[model samples]
Target: MLASLAQRFIALTLLATVGTAVSAQTLSSDQRVLKIERMAHGLDIPWAFDFLPDGSVLITEKDGDLLHLAAGRLTRVKGTSKVLDQGQGGLLDVLIPRNFDRTRRIYLSYSKRLGRGSATAVATGQLARRNTQLEGLRDIFVAAPPADSGRHFGSRLAEGPDGTLYVTLGDRGDRPSAQSLTSHQGSILRLNPDGSVPRDNPFTKQKGAQPEIWSYGHRNPQGLTFAADGQLWSVEHGARGGDEVNLIEKGANYGWPVIAYGRHYSGLKIGEGTTKPGLKQPAHYWDPSMAPSNLLVYSGSMWPDWRGDIFVGSLKFGYIARLSGQPLAEVEQIRGDETGRIRDLREAPDGSIWFLSETNGALYRLSR
Candidate 1:
């Protein structure tokens, strides 16, 4: 399927965006024509963004800025949490809950200073009616056993079908901690809206495990989302070439360090080969590591032919990868001059695709 899609991949670049009239590119792939436009620019390391109920956008800058973009203007949203802003630790994902229209509540995931080191934390706040500030912002959950390392916070948030929040946390560069149930490191946490543990959580009845843990044995899971069918999925950074997209399951263990398809940065083998008896295998993996940032399972409202497909932003390769079909495969790679270091890929409210480019410090939109 991958080879066939590669042979059929066709792209036609049109006029680049200059004044909000022309598009940056008119790309053709997967039998669809996609128009890419630069929606906003001059951002400083915009990591993640989500659309609000009023057609505005809330963007998170890794340097601790919450920007509200509306009417072609960027306004700084005050009263956000103070982040560490060291290494990969800083302001990250922004999530607008499904009930935002009634609650005006928003969620943010960032690297919070904990004791000596920084840990991934999730916070909620009420967006002021004026959209210029956040009111009553408070931390909901923070990962435990913070490490001194400044890498791999893995701060991404997704609201489950049941209104629960799921947060991804990295291993803090500690490989073995992924296998430990006592620590929240390298795990995906599921919590109620108020930061309390769900009564029916997978580990709530377990003796030593953290009650917030939904799944374990992840290295640095940055990309997290749910499909229309309510199934959860995640994409995580692997050692050298084993970047993976896994189907997240409750109480399941995804083998990291113990069994991985990639080798260490030192070119040494990881774990005891790829396959293990009990560990879960990835739905798909990339060799040479694309430094995946976010995952989106497209609904295909604009391009209906591509429904149920997966789109991933590549921070290292500077492109958006489209994965589809059963047993998932990388069907196409969308690249353009505007696609530098793609940081976040999200399906907008109108079914258009919005992505952040760290290399360009811009936000771009894609539609048919």
Candidate 2:
């Protein structure tokens, strides 16, 4: 979870009084008697999921395998790009575009191999099923300035209402680079589906800043999504502590190595303090660290009560943390003991909750 191959609440005055509140149902972790069914197995760190129009699910494994599961059949799709799969980097997030039925297109984000290191890369290609494999894949986006670090590949993809693709990148273990505008490390980048920088991006006019960057000062953002209100939110890893859930905004600076609620792994302090001028504070945070891997803003009908709640996969604590509040806050953690090392979670088209467990190499679904 850390750049070292390891893994805050708001400061009231520091937080802007403006922003939409996050709402959630008051369900406790122990209250749900939902059934947990193992949907798939033999996976290695399944990182992302999306339901196709035909009810099949597209899943991406961190070890560079693209799997298509339908009606209890699992297909290991071919044409997957080779991944660098070191420490925490590998084939990560997969997405089924809203226009998939007509376009037959799906998006993929992975650790693009470069020499001994890798950088986050995304590609979209027409998906056509042929027997047990997939074909017709092509690239769309590649993270600039690839670093040779094995940790902190914050590669997650989310599509905005207008079809803009949002990607999160880590500091790539280069802490000071996060504060630099010249580097792509530690930033949430926005791009067109074809991988070009948007003209209206936050830093487009800046001389040295990367044109794709939308927000800066992130540590290792592993999850990204758009809320019903069209607000972007992210969850990221901290060193020894200070895991954060942030409401992302254009050109906003999230104090990371500069200021953190979590201390160093050596038990020392971090940054000058938790609050500073100009930098943004997290909507919610965890001190002991959840080692969160992904996030979902639930608007599904199956769990009517969870309409506006945020679901997070807890890699370190092994559970799902549901967060909600007016200004966004941690509400409850669910199924800690039963679900082991959750890597990712998604709400199926049928309204069921499907989550991946890295520890068990399996996919589990929860429903009433």
Candidate 3:
């Protein structure tokens, strides 16, 4: 199904608020004439997906299903690790290695149930076409100190320009853990393609520090993506209001509960105001909480005009916010027929925009 611009704009206008920080890009009705095409449906909160060079797509369902979508059909990819599928925990992110055509390796992040506890774990395996399953599965990274809580398993993956992979891990619903160096929770981890730690990891020599940590102090980062310039970016949820879009920096500390633009959910202040010494502020923040899920700095051909603009999926508002400029600001909000609880989004190899909608249980593509 194709969605018209008139229909999309009506939804966007309804959700549009007046106070978002604006950029130099002038708002015009002419640019609203884009289209949304339904790519797939009947998915169960399809969390993340990556496209193979052969035009096939691999998607991770939160319920532990690894599905291959090709030629208008979906097939279950077997040999997946057992996922806990509890509240906010399960098969979360799927990524095709940068050299997938040669290696056939895929990376996955899931909530691993280990004995009586569970934690976010990343494993890699070779994809086999003959049997439609992964082979030689082995975990390369696991968040230290397992937890019983089923929330905040930020598992989005993005390949850095240097061929290393970046993984986002949440604070495990334990606020203080984010500020601690001994824990892998609430930090962005950088690892070599084969799951080895980069020798120059930021905290490699710090006493009582996890060598895999790249950046620390995050709430529940759900989105990870590389900008056109190869810089890494993330989007994370705040307590009551302050959802954040951060530019991931090596060795930097992104202040979480201790210093946020949000409150404690009970209307109380969070941390030492919005700014404190040695803590990083967000590039952009949502005041009333958009419940941001993922970030995409578009370089797609379909939207040449938006080549360098930043796009983020907003879960709470059921829309995509088109942002641009440094210290990014919200420029526009886009909504289509199936755009409900946006989960993750990406630009296809063909330069089209593809996204998964958790609320609609479907996938969609924005194309010219």
The candidate that wins on lDDT is 1
Tens-digit lDDT track for model 3 on 1-368?
Answer: 23653453333333221111121121222356655665566676789998998988888999897877775556668899988999899999998877888889999999999778899999999999653889998998888999989999998999988889999999989999998989999999999988888999988899999889999899999999998798888999998989999988999999987899989888999888999899998999998999988888888577677888878898888888988877578988887556789999999988878889998766677766
RMSD, model 3, all Cα superposed? Answer: 8.6
Arranged by lDDT, best first: 1, 3, 2
Q: How far is candidate 2 from the true structure (C-alpha RMSD, Å)?
A: 10.7
Q: Which candidate is the best by TM-score?
A: 1
Among residues 3 or more apart in sequence or in different chains, the pairs in candidate 1 whose N, CA or C atoms overlap within 3 Å are none
Worst 10 residues of 3 by lDDT: 17-26
Selected candidate, larger TM-score, 2 vs 3: 3
Error at 366, model 1, angstroms: 0.4
| Residue-level lDDT for 51 in candidate 3 | 94
Local distance difference test values of all predictions, in order: 0.88, 0.80, 0.84
* Best-first order by TM-score: 1, 3, 2
Worst 10 residues of 2 by lDDT: 7-16
